[model samples]
Target: MSFTTAPSRWSDVWLVTAARGISSCGDFLAASALTLTLQSAGAGGLAVSGLLLAATLPLVALAPLTGRLADRVDSRTLLVLAGLAQAGICVALANTGGPTLMIVLVGLLAVGLAVTQPVLAALIPAMVRPADLARASALQQSAGTLGALAGPALAGVLVGSFGTRLPLLVDAASYLALVAAGLLIRTRRGGGRRPGPVATGAGIEARAWRLRRDPLLLATVIGVAGVVGAVGAINVVEVFFIRETLHSSTTTYGLVTAAWTLGMLAGAWIFARAVARLRRDGALAGAALALLGGCCLMVLVSAAVPSALLLVPIWVVGGLCNGGDNVFGNVLMARRVPEPVRGRAFAVYVGAVQGASMVGYLAGGLLLELLSPRPLVAGAGLAGLAAVAVLAVPLRRAARAERDVRPVSRDEPASAGEDAEPGAGLATPVPGR
Candidate 1:
């Protein structure tokens, strides 16, 4: 709350950032290794999709429970225990041989991720003041992007030399970083209330934050989910696209995919500098939409690249957009939502994204049987672009609504007709649910 706490907050940010980067590297290492193993075995797109589904379903299904748990339980406890469990699960996965068993283990790994995701997300806002939220989000995002950038390339090399099990082991080791971070992080969100825990008890009862309630957040979240859904199948199609369509080697696939993540790293910092200028939540939301659209445009353009080498530049462009989008979304959530309900908001957002990705995964598997990789990639791009176009109008309306209304302080009552969305209330408080 005070400038005195600034040093501590930045420290907390660094600790979280380091741990996140390492853990992300492990996750991607394991994933790329597994995908490589499956593809090299000629297991086909359905097999890959099934693998993806296993990893994703628990996040969507568990969002409600995990979100509440994030709010109700100690973050340190969750991170320490979840990280340890994930490490053990990865070890088991490495030793196991069967695809069915592998899928099951991956799902278990994701269970840890689901818990940690919201826990960390909610805690970041708690660590820093309002002015620093954008920078903190950028740091947090950059860590994840950097970790992701490292993971696949590591997997590519490790898998080629020592086989899949070694990369899996490395991933297992990465979980310990989360455990260390949990122990080291000074900031924690839990059953105990922090400063300004809830705006008003009556307001909490009448109008809890829900993703569907705010027009801007609702529209922003839905738009993001839509785009992810549109592009999700690209994950499934890409292995084949790189390996078969472009005749690239396995290592090439891993390295090239990482280029997007590298771009994401740069984009996070790049956008963070600009975020201060976009003070309004509406402006932030609009920026996110624009970035998402740019990402899709890059995807559409990638359809024509004749070689895998060419994908690096295209994906870099997309990755930059992706990273910027992430920063804006995080800033939007931290800016607009009250502190107490942030856990639920982030969980719901993550769930929406994973769920949309689930749909895309299934579609990709089915479509692979009917169409080749190039056309499928093109279609995915077009679908994502269309989602952006359709969502633009709602975003504009939300922006206009924001511009029209004078903002209210926490002690004041919200305007009666400020928002008409059902079950909606002000970020502070309002008369109606």
Candidate 2:
């Protein structure tokens, strides 16, 4: 997994990363343009919220089917087809003029995105060795962060110069790049197996039941959902906070976002080194929670200070913590979930997080009408800290249990079901089954 080992070992990882970066850039570009277009059309807050919801709600609703497909199909082909579908959706969006039609098109694009996420997540562990998982995750996240950082700024320029249509076209072109990268990826299908029987609703339920039986996995998913929900609230109110509380212009808000993105990049780079040092599961989990708590505290502090200049540093710190948490969380999932069940596990995890975020978004909008942004942001910070405190003991115990269990090597058969004994690590075989 080290750079000195072999270049071929990490080639698929880089290709996946590249594809993700390109895809993310397109997403942000389209998102920014869509927001601007909606605003220009005199769309109200509720309409804007609906548009955002349309873009995210599909992920929550379609998780079960998408996860099953990720497990039963070739991820490479899935990703490529998804990208093509999105490209077509964007083209349809470009042709549409009505707000309702545009919303439907965006929802269709989100469906394509929803399918790609779990497939790509499940494909990652197969792209590299076990020891390289953390580094690879960090690298992939950094790529996506960089794309997010650039996308909006580029969109702003493009929109100002040529209106929203050009940016939409650019986004369509970006998907083609994603398809090309996906085609280049050489990973095995379903982590090295032929397509299994199509997963029925009963089979999906059984897989979900298996996940619930695993204490550590269940805890991780819930904890992540809580944190994401808190963050989502902050996002919903951030623009209002900047404009009303800090008396800042849109440009200042963009600058603050850029600073956060820079911090995320730095944090991802740091994680590439830190993961190797923090080999213990408990320690990594503890470190990640600490960082997340610190991020929440920074938000609280920024709200209290209420200065545009001060917000930049606060957001940078928050972004750093977020980047680290993302890396650790993904690595943890990759380690804990069996390859055969990873698609379902990721599906549950992603669905929970997105559902929580949707709740936060709705709640934030309702709360904003009645309350100030500062208090809401502070509340989010407190909620994140509370989650960390509540989960501390269980997470530590899970870490200790995992520390004693050796991982099943990548060369071993990964087709075995989730038969691992309690506390025997994630990939062990059940005695009789």
Candidate 3:
């Protein structure tokens, strides 16, 4: 478990980054296409919610298994296999009919995502030394943001002209990038890989790493999950809020969404430079929470806007925070979690967020049946802010807990033992578990 990584693999990292972006675009493309297809076919709100559930459920439910799988299996094997499986499923999904069948296919697609997400997340840390983590995290995040920005727009155009089948097929094709990247990228981990410690006597310390055992990490994860749960309902409410209350055109809404993605892309780079200087785990945790609060504050303010056009500027600010917060969380994890179990940690972290988002999505759907969109939007923001406020106590306690521990220089050891302080964790690669 004590093996050091090869010097930062920027070229290999870019291969993974490009592949991730391409696959991510496909994911969004298929999602957008499917949603449009369902709506055009006169599917009810329940059906749409169910579709969303299908797409998300596997990611949350399979974390324990997938996390371990990511740790035990080879990255190249996982990426290539999962990518091929997803592509085949998407191809089938494109030609298939019926809500039930399509829903099942979507769930299967999520199965691939559950496997690959942690693999890529954990791999990025191993791609570079701790000094380059912020840049890598930002680049990876920016890729995802750009994918999000592009996917829906591409889906809109393709689905409008050629129907969902073409767009979905395009999605299937995107998986080829992953397969190529898997074959091309030189740096690899898992399957008893180089950087992670073997489970020998001394390396037991590496495998012993756990999120709950680290209070700062646990608090940060919990706080972020809570905020996500509190605000996730906004995703459901926003369309109705913007169209009905703000009286905006569909084009305006699209632009507003794009603005947020653009903001996040900008924020990822902006915060990458800013947060690298924040060398303490405690500080990174605080900054992430603060940025999340800012994201929600924008959501809350959007509820009061008179026109959807105005939301563009507001969302840009919000998206920036969201993107920046995302980087902080990734960097924080890469720093604290031992390299051996980093994949499992990331899987758990993603499952937590996905689970929280499921609850929020359900709440948004259920609430929309009984409440106005504006109130729900405002309430989502308030709930997120409140969650952050409540989390302050635990975060403060975590900071104090670190006070008694000795500080490790940035160049020192990366042991993840409970006795090791935030500075030591900061010197390490990452801890998402």
Candidate 4:
């Protein structure tokens, strides 16, 4: 489908999202396989969780620097490098039998994954017309969720028979394939990286660094942080909840995670449709309200101890909100931030998200260990609602500003044109799917 708000050449954008999905499937399969591998090797619950956390911590830690790097260099090259690194790490992980080696490999994998996200995010505007940002974001979000749903199931089968090494090998191949695909897709847009400060003599870099002070961006970070916190909390607690409350096994826990992915897929589809019709800002506000309601419902359900059918409803709500939120958030970021600093802005955004998630994971793990899963889950839901409530005013103001700017940007010429308006800068390129 074409959009007046999108570029004339949107087909390329779809290709990127599709490639992303393929890559995600491989990554997830590797992750699932790795988790199982550690479990089968007599890793304790804390150890398995610790391995997962270690892999993610690098992403959080390196996000700011990675973002800065993306702004200074070609995002596609970075993307290719990150993918290759992931492939290499998977290979290392596959060959290793020692838990220490496994942990180290996992940490490397996290660094690769962490660095790729911002670059990928910065690339969206380059692949599509500015007007189509919301649609593209929605599609990407859906692809990711769907990939998550399929990856684990595939990995489970592979690990059940061939053992974990095969899945890691497959993941490595997927990354190599992504690199090939990235190399084939060419664009005139410069990499999202900004020039270095002072010594580097890149005036552009200095200006971008200043954008870190933007109140709108700060608000976005705070809002996203809240959502990330809730997501992490659920991620940490859900398995334990299913195990303890529902008396489920590992397979069932995996299925529950898949259910969440299914919800996210459905949500992304719905959110994309909504954005195509209502525009991103309005659609986002509406979706946020719906999500907040769902969270409230979750709290009630937690108290009541609902049936299996009830669980489906909760999954649907969570998935829909999560998917919608992602699309909306990306649209906002793309629209609001200056293109020159997109890499750093996205990096900051990513770091904030990871930071929130880190806190959430640690807190959730501790809380779950000390208290009941019901309280943790319900508390997160309530906290999500409270977050939405707090951000309502600022979100409204930002949305108004975005709508005001959209028309002016639409009337301007493409950045490649000499006649391009003064404020009409080129979009940043990204490496992530």
Q: Report the lDDT tens digits of candidate 4 across residue range 213-320.
A: 444455556665665565456555555565566665445545555665676667655654444343334334445445544544554355345443356556656666
Best by TM-score: 1
lDDT of 2 by residue, 306-357 (tens): 4887877777887777666665665555445556666777777777778877
TM-score of each: 0.89, 0.80, 0.88, 0.76
lDDT of 3 by residue, 1-433 (tens): 2323468888987998799789878987888678667756866456666777787799889999999888889999999999999999999999998999999999999999999988887787667765555456556666767887788667767877788899889999999899999988887888867453444211235657777777888888888888888888877666567656777644455456667777777776677666546666787789888998998898888888887778888888988887778767766775566677877888888888878877777887788778888899899889888988998789978866775573536853332221211111111000000
Error of 2 at 218 (Å): 1.3
Question: Ten-residue segment with the worst summed lDDT in candidate 3?
Answer: 424-433
Which sections of candidate 3 miss by over 4 Å? 1-7, 40-42, 129-134, 194-204, 243-251, 407-433
Worst 10 residues of 1 by lDDT: 424-433
Task: Please report, as a residue range, the 10-residue window in candidate 4 with the lowest summed lDDT.
Answer: 424-433
The lDDT ranking, best first, is 1, 3, 2, 4
lDDT of 4 at 149: 79
Assess the local accuracy of residue 201 in candidate 1 as a C-alpha lDDT between 0 and 100: 14
Clashes of each: 0, 0, 11, 11
Candidate 3 local lDDT, residue 71: 81
> lDDT at 84 for candidate 1?
98
Q: How do the residues 378-415 of candidate 1 rate in per-residue lDDT, one tens digit apiece?
A: 99888888988988888889778856874534443121
lDDT of each: 0.76, 0.65, 0.73, 0.59
